[model samples]
Target chain A: MSNHDTHEHGDPIAEIKKVTIILSVLTIIELILGFWMIGVTSEGGRLAIKGTIVILMLAKAFYIVAYFMHLKHELKNLIMTIVVPLALFIWFITAFLSDGNSFRNLRNTYDPHFKEQATIKVEAKEGHHGEEGAHATEAKEAAPATEAKEAAPAKAAETEKK
Target chain B: MSNVTTASTKEAKWWNGGKSPFDVEYGKVMMWYFLMSDAFTFGAFLIAYGTVRFSTNGWPNPNEVFKSYPFAGEGTNAPLVFVSIMTFILIVSSVTMVLAVHAGKMMDKKGVVRNMILTIIGGIAFLSCQAWEWNHLHHEGAWWGMNPFINADGTASSTNFTNFFFTITGFHGFHVFSGVVINIIMLIMTLTNQFEKRGHYLMIEKAGLYWHFVDLVWVFVFTCFYLL
Candidate 1:
């Protein structure tokens, strides 16, 4: 290339090395946190650990974008143009996750037969007709395990017999 | 457009503007725009993942699910050691990409070529590691053909987590694969004197932006999928 003077960007080697180090450090910290949090049983402790690791992850992301991708040196508007729209995704996540959670809660409450144990509860509300009712009652009596949650495992083993 | 008069341009001068409006070359400005949109795309995928995770009653423990490493067979030393290595590969590749862009500015064709090659190799290595992980997961039991959600039958399966795991990582893996492909083409062009003939290696710099974006996405993936 003849006109090296045309592209007058500064030497990025030093910044690259710094970023590499920072990233490595963050990675190590996250690894340690992941493992350490595994043993933590308390919900609060786990959430706190999750928060810490997320912050570290974002830090690494910033270095990769700014130094390696060269965005840090670019015009401020260029950065804003990206960040402004990207910020909306946070809202999207919040909206969707809450909606999904509500859906799950509704399913768990109403879909009693959806899980094995919920079968007994549904059977109580369900009325039986003449001849089939007696045979079905006999079948229910033949089955083992009364706990609702055990319904799944009990049904699984019962099916194995067939 | 209505004309706005300025002091220096009182006469009809040859110059139209003093500096680039975006304050960068047209190619670079466009690349940034492309990457920004792409970042949001990845963000939406991750958000969907988080939604699925929250909605599911029994989300598989990611650490337990990802415990196996390549060749260790079944139980492994650390849950996320392999993915951590993958992360390292991408991070180092981003660094090499920086060197490539730096070399491009200095007009060192050889340095640019070498670093681009290294970056490409790193990308390939990352994809290989991912494939290994996927294969290991398959044999360890969840594949596309087998549904993790066995429903009311009570089979020991990972219904929700597996779905999102495959979806999110597969998407990011696709991105990494494409970045590698782009780098290979850029490498070929660099070696064949395409950019040299153009008098600047901005091509390498642009590819570096893409490589860094891929790495950036991996950071989020590693956190959301493996670590968190």
Candidate 2:
């Protein structure tokens, strides 16, 4: 502890307060955007909102890591050691997500059942029950729900044989 | 001799052999790297989630699934309200952790204990909220392979929705659980005057890092599962 005189000479308590406020505000904005997203029906608008949420999410992460975790105050070497390897995530996300998109395209093109499932709209049940009724009907509801779930995979398997 | 001098001088003062390169202790460095590896773990899980979500044609809209709060009755339509509360709890607890670390820097045991206790309370509160949400979902028949909700477009959805939800959130919850345990142990050590005898509360700083990492992970998990 004696050898560690590396922390910046500043009012750390004040800095903590500032960072806390920033994190909270970021979260609130993100929530607002989330609520806005629910009301937005257009695909482009939802994407723009979602993209903003992501940027805000990254900002919140930066504040948490830089201030709360004190990474920004650390030595340059230490910071590089930590941050550089994280670059791997860029390619990680790109490759995986692109592959996923490709997989979806392939499935939709070849897998008849997969395409059919998307087109088949089931009735929206009165799924959410009152708190008092929830407990009583939990068991009764589980039977049909599980039966439907089981039937889905069975149907997929039957389709595969064709 | 000139070449050797140039090479030696190129290295920063802290990087010189007589002192630690990072100007911090080995414990803190290890904790950072541990968190780094842990970040990859979470990243992989989230990426896998993204992969599955992209590959699937339909998904349960989070707004529909997470639209209830505690004591708000079973048919509440309040999306993101409960989760926002949970998010604030974690952020506030993280602030308390910062205070604990700051108090440790000032050698104030009382401040450290108070903040640590508050942090533990926050952790427990978050876990309780999660328990309620999970129970609610379970009641609605959402489990590893069971999903009661349909896709946003009113299509028959895949079980992957419930499957990924449980696995990722469950993993993050496990991290939170472990973080609480670590904080509890730190609390006990503080109470026993262990850091007092050692003349430093570096251990608390390390614990704070772990706790903040837990909070950090929650940011991603919340966005991935609840918000996005």
- Candidate 2's residue-wise lDDT over B1-228, tens digit each? 333333433365655576567667899999999999999999999999999998888887999989999888756899999999999999999999999998888888999999999999999999999999899887666777656677888776667888889998889889889989999999999999999999999999999999999999999999988888
Model 2 TM-score relative to the real fold: 0.88
- Local accuracy by lDDT, each model: 0.71, 0.83
lDDT of 1 at B43: 82
lDDT of 2 by residue, A52-162 (tens): 998999999999999899998776788899999999999999999999999999999999988887887766645473111112234336544434234444333423533
Worst 10 residues of 1 chain B by lDDT: B1-10
Residue runs of model 2 more than 4 Å from their true location after superposition: A1-7, A129-162, B1-11
Q: What DockQ does every candidate get?
A: 0.26, 0.43
B-chain TM-score for every candidate: 0.85, 0.94
Q: List the residue pairs that clash in candidate 2.
A: none
